[model samples]
Target: MQYIRNFCIIAHIDHGKSTLADRLLERTQTIHSRDRKNQLLDDMELERERGITIKSHAIQMEYKYKGVSYILNLIDTPGHVDFSYEVSRSIYACEGALLVVDAVKSIQAQTVSNLFLAIDRNLTIIPILNKIDLPVANKEKVTYEIMYLIGCTSEEVIYSSAKEGRGIDKILEAIICKIHPPKGNLKAPLQALIFDSFYNTFRGVEAYFKVINGQIRKGDKIKFMSSGKMYTAEEIGNLRLKHISKSIIRSGDVGYIISGIKDTLSIKVGDSFTSVNRPAKAIIAGFKKVNPMVFAGLYPEKTEDYDNLRVSIEKLHLNDASLTFFPESSIFLGSGFRCGFLGMLHLEIIQERLEREYGISVITTIPNVSYKVFLKCSPTDIFLVDNPSDMPDIFNIERLEEPYIKASIITQVNYVGAIMSLCIKKRGMIKNQYYLMPQRVELIFEMPLSEIIFNFYDRLKTISKGYASFDYSPLDYRFSDIVLVKILINHQLVDALSTLEHRSNAFYIGKKMCKKLQKIIPRQQFDISIQATIENKIIARETIKAVRKDVTAKCYGGDISRKRKLLLKQKKGKKKCSLLVK
Candidate 1:
């Protein structure tokens, strides 16, 4: 009999998705005392350090309550704005979702988005109000708000204190009783959804899937519909619910299969499985390609570390398929690679891993968001760019289109006046506002993503005194005044750190960033002038103020070689560094 319940845990940042998973694993005894670790499903060191789920993870557990064994497959997804696309993919793989809401903070920006995705998938939703032990948990208000927003009956909600391991059994029972199980053929042509996969050094490639229709087992030749590639399954095993003996997985069971395949290019997320003899068409229509939102130039500081960087990138690509890289060269930095990522967090994670895991020091240029430019012509053209150097020559651009985002701000009504001023300063237009509660309002705005590129969220929180919450998504590409602020030291342009900004704060931000870079540049043994120039005219300028005492006036001849060599080596060493600190 195939009795399986598939679901994902979705919540806002710091709302206890990972912590809930830990409690479930402990209650179910999936990990033995010796094998246990904190946030077991997170698995990545970076994810643990950041206290955020960067990549989605899946694990199966079996619960036997009153002699009824229920198999549960849970996927933990990223809750941040940058990982929204990945969250969508994770939602698609399951038929139900455990919508976790903090009892105190209640509904949030991502809470709405994740609920919508679950509804779109037509999945059975089980809302769990968590963290009731907290002093601020307002059960009545949060419960009422959830019912109104998600349209779930108040009786359908379940309350739990996942921290104290309370009410976990009831949550599990609700899943088995309410969530629907899969009903598909076991002997029919094979069809499975490849939700996740990883490269194993010993086993080659291991893929996990939920069989929708058909029976698959060891030694059966399988084909990936999207890539049109063939491989034979060497082994098949289900996830041990309580660290017990491995059992054979059937239809609707979440299990892992190992094959001789080694590369990730062959099998991709959203790909389907089929028998080699009777193949089924892949469901490649709705799976949108992961687009890189930010681009930056990444290079090893030491020219000799080039090989190490390449290896690091390849290893990173094993877990992150969205990352892309290409060979690039610059007159100032020589040969390097330009890499693309989903967002800032994705970029930072990769850079940190390269340094910590691979022991390679890298020089990264400023990150840039994509922009589309249209020229006046019979046929309009579109360009996707990451570097300001690639922006259309100002003279040729008739209309420029940059990505705009629909942002929502939630704050106490009393601070609405202050937040409005900050928005105006950033050139954001007010869309609308609604009363979310007695004293809270959700303010809407249509702002350029570029406007909020630099510490916009932090500033919003500061203005509201940590009472503001933000959520934004891409609205559309609209025409805007896109200007590049070029930084020049002593009248020489620095291509490495040039940035595109709204013309409103151009002068102030440019001057501040330039001053920051100049401070870090170590007073070049000579007087240096810093300037921010656009076109041929300067918008901001500052002087380094000549260093009067760099040389040792009392040094003897014997120590000249050591000191000269030291200075020469220092100059050669930090060569990748440029600009003063602001």
Candidate 2:
């Protein structure tokens, strides 16, 4: 019998997936007793600093219980909305999931969304109610609430405090007893599902996968199902706790393979691998290509650092596949790459890494959304518009459907009226409201994605006084008034800085972006006007005052040669204009 166990931990952001993984690593003795570093699963610097798992990390451990040595593969997946697609891929790699619900917070929108994904994948789910050791301990009530939402029996719920190391053994014991092992042909043709990949300075590309069938050994030739590219595996290995070790990953084993494939483009996160000797047909259903909802152009502040920017992006792609980039030149920014990302946090992470790791200073354009537009007299059109210069020429786009999200707010009942008013101001339509308890209520709203792009988060905090927790997921796009808002530098429409926004929220966003850009750009030689144009008509404008120190006080010539050199220096200063686009 194949004694393999595969499972993923699903939870809301900050609900302790990483912490639970740390406990699991400790209980399994993956790390030595002396190792004191916490959150061992989140090894990345960015992941540790952000206190969230950016990518799904896997670790394998061998545990002996009841005289049987069991192999357990634990996949720590992302909990944020930006990586929801990756979360799904992680789910596919496992036969069961351990849904970690915050004992105090109960069920959240992401928790519900992840549970639905697990159900859709037909994975056996074991819901664990965490945070019992806190002062507000209501494990029984939390268990009741989870069972009510998930339709599970009260007995199926497991309560624990992952932080204090309480009930961890029960969690592990439940995995062994309740979760089922893989049911596939172990000795058949090799077919491994590559869920995640990372780059090592010494090891090239490390592709982590779950072997469904057939045996994979060192020095075997393999092919990626999606890329159709062949590569020779230098070594096939499995994670012994956190370290990758050389081992024969047979059927029903969750492991990683190191191949000579150095280029990240050849190995995609959701790609499948098959043996050259016995190639199996690829199943493309599990991997859904993540479309970047937000777009931004990253420009090197120093023109000479363009190559460094490219190198940084290339390195970033080694681990982050959701980020897409294309060579783009702007009238104001000149040569740069327009990058698309899952959301604001994803964009910030990439930008911070580019500056910190690559040692390049960059100026990024305000992010905009991709829209689907339908002309009044022509066929449907789908394209991206970041700057106003890219707007369609004189074409009457009667209607457009921008994306919106179904947002849920869980707060004290006292704050419901305030949150409801805030939602209304953001053009949100209330769908449902329910009381989890007498004091806590869940407020559901369908809100346009544009409304939450900037300071909506800050606004929420201000209104709720940090008492409200929010979660949201993408809803279907609906028809709305689409306006093309273009940002202009010195009254000239900059094609690289335009955005397609809903008519209802265009002025607010346009004004907001102008403020951000104004704060970054230095005062110019002349008063620079920042304008927002809609359909070639200027709707908003902001003035940046001229720099007072642009001109230098002259000094009398000491020598004939010195006088000529001073004139030349003055001419060069005139060429270095402060206005970005004049």
Q: Write the per-residue lDDT of candidate 1 for residues 260-310, one digit (tens) a residue.
A: 886756777678878897776555356657777678899889888887788
Compared with the true structure, all predictions reach lDDT values of 0.78, 0.79
The pairs that clash in candidate 2 are 386-498, 387-497, 387-498, 388-498, 389-495
TM-score on alpha carbons, each prediction:
0.88, 0.88
Best by lDDT: 2
TM-score between candidate 2 and the true structure: 0.88
Task: Encode model 2's per-residue lDDT on 12-125: one tens digit a residue.
Answer: 888888888889888888889887577787777888888888887888877777889898998898887777766887898888999998877677667777888899888989
The list of candidate 1 runs beyond 4 A from truth reads 34-37, 240-248, 376-379, 549-582
- For model 2, the superposed segments whose C-alpha errors exceed 4 Å read 241-244, 380-388, 394-398, 436-439, 510-525, 544-582
